[model samples]
Target: MERILLQLSYNGADFQGFQIQNEGRTVQYELERILKRMHKDFIRIHPSSRTDKGVHALMQYVHFDTTLSLPTNKWQHAFNSALPDDIYINEVTKINADFHSRYDCVGKAYRYKVYKAPHRDVLKRGIETHITETLDTRKMNEAAQYFIGTHDFTSFCSAKTEIENKERTMYKFEVIETDTGYEFFVIGSGFLYNMVRIMVHFLMDVGRGKRQGSEIPAIIAASDRTKAGKTAPAEGLYLEKIYLSPEELTQDIPKGTTITLKPTRRQLTQQS
Candidate 1:
């Protein structure tokens, strides 16, 4: 009955998305299959967030229950040995029973890379989106600052969202110019469906002079999906990290059996 938290990272080029689906392959489905093969039982891996198709994850958190007495290192070794090269489990730890990878997360960060050059590199085709339009990085960066703070981000979300709450806190949102492209990074306490992508789309539009940068505030005020820009391509987005405050990571003792032969305190500290 012990909970095992897995640090997951994947390319996300070939998979449909993070969740298990009936139509095509997915990260969760593959992980679940490996888990069933290893334990001979269905093990559910609860992901921190559900990324859209073609979206990548540099670091993703997932948790599952395991009854095996094997150590965390053994679990990691077993899982990695079975998983394909494209998908890797960076770390595994025995977390507090009450800790949830998704619900307990305090924030999520994502990065969208746009290649602005005319020539495209074949190597980066799957990782970065190519756009030849000349952009004003300064204006885009200025526009990004408007998104920082708590707001009703209904206008930036996808029309397909079924979630009730569109209110989310944008702690940090910035656009940085790179050697070959521009990177749009956003950190938020929560996000609605395709919120980051839509935000990026607006910024791109602003960079291209299609819309004034100040229109962002009006769009936020409007809270209408049509007021925002288009949703950016999924290939350019990556789930950078998920944060859980130290307080949230701590255990709240409950009426449950504790494992006796768990790793030492020092080893457990390294897990975080």
Candidate 2:
């Protein structure tokens, strides 16, 4: 069997999350169903990350095995025909059988948009978190810089995580104001559950003067979830990109086959 990796994007507002569930519309379930229809057998897909419900993704990655004989470039067209309006395959390629989307990723970048205006736009309401509190963008930007470089992020993760190591590297972190809102971009080797959201929460609190900028180091040192701010809502979060090694990206393969994505909302509705 030939392994291929598919790169895609989706508007996650209507779905429960990225993972397959017994009863909910998910990205995995939709993709899996489509793949089974094509293969007439079970096809397993591995993704770089499982974004939370209401979260979106611009460059999500997944790998699956297929025996189709078409060229890699053509898989994009074939897959898009089966994808729903909310999701689309942007790119497709064959890769080494051992190349895994999750483990092979060097890093990931996520962006959280915050609408800081007095009133929210109808279109913007679902994509961004509306914050009326007057924020010092400069101060927030300055505080976010502290998050760069390697550090123990135990304090910033949600208490739900079972991972033992809270240590991760932050390659980049910045906050910039836009025409109607503020944007927070974070790039890291990896992230803990709710780590980015929690960090955004803390920074928002700092921007509003609810927390001191100088207190960040203390929060990191405390290694306690209670010391951090609330996990930001999932609507504002998006899996922006995944950085793959050159070897993983340049592999050759046969095509006519592609990975599938499951929509999250359908299963949830069925469950209810």
By TM-score, who's the top model here?
1
lDDT top scorer: 1
TM-score of each model, in listed order: 0.89, 0.87
Name the TM-score of candidate 1.
Answer: 0.89
Model 1 Cα lDDT, one tens digit per residue, 118-232: 7887888779999987789899988888987778898899888899878887766788889888999887776799998899988999999898778888989997899896899
Steric collisions counted per model: 0, 21
Evaluate residue 196 in candidate 1 and report its C-alpha lDDT on the 0 to 100 scale.
87
lDDT of 2 by residue, 88-185 (tens): 88878777666677877766889998887667767875588988867888999889878876789989998889999888877667888888778889
Q: State the lDDT at 221 in candidate 2.
A: 94
Q: Which ten residues in a row have the lowest lDDT in candidate 2?
A: 263-272
> Candidate 1: deviation at residue 149, Å?
0.8
lDDT of 1: 0.82
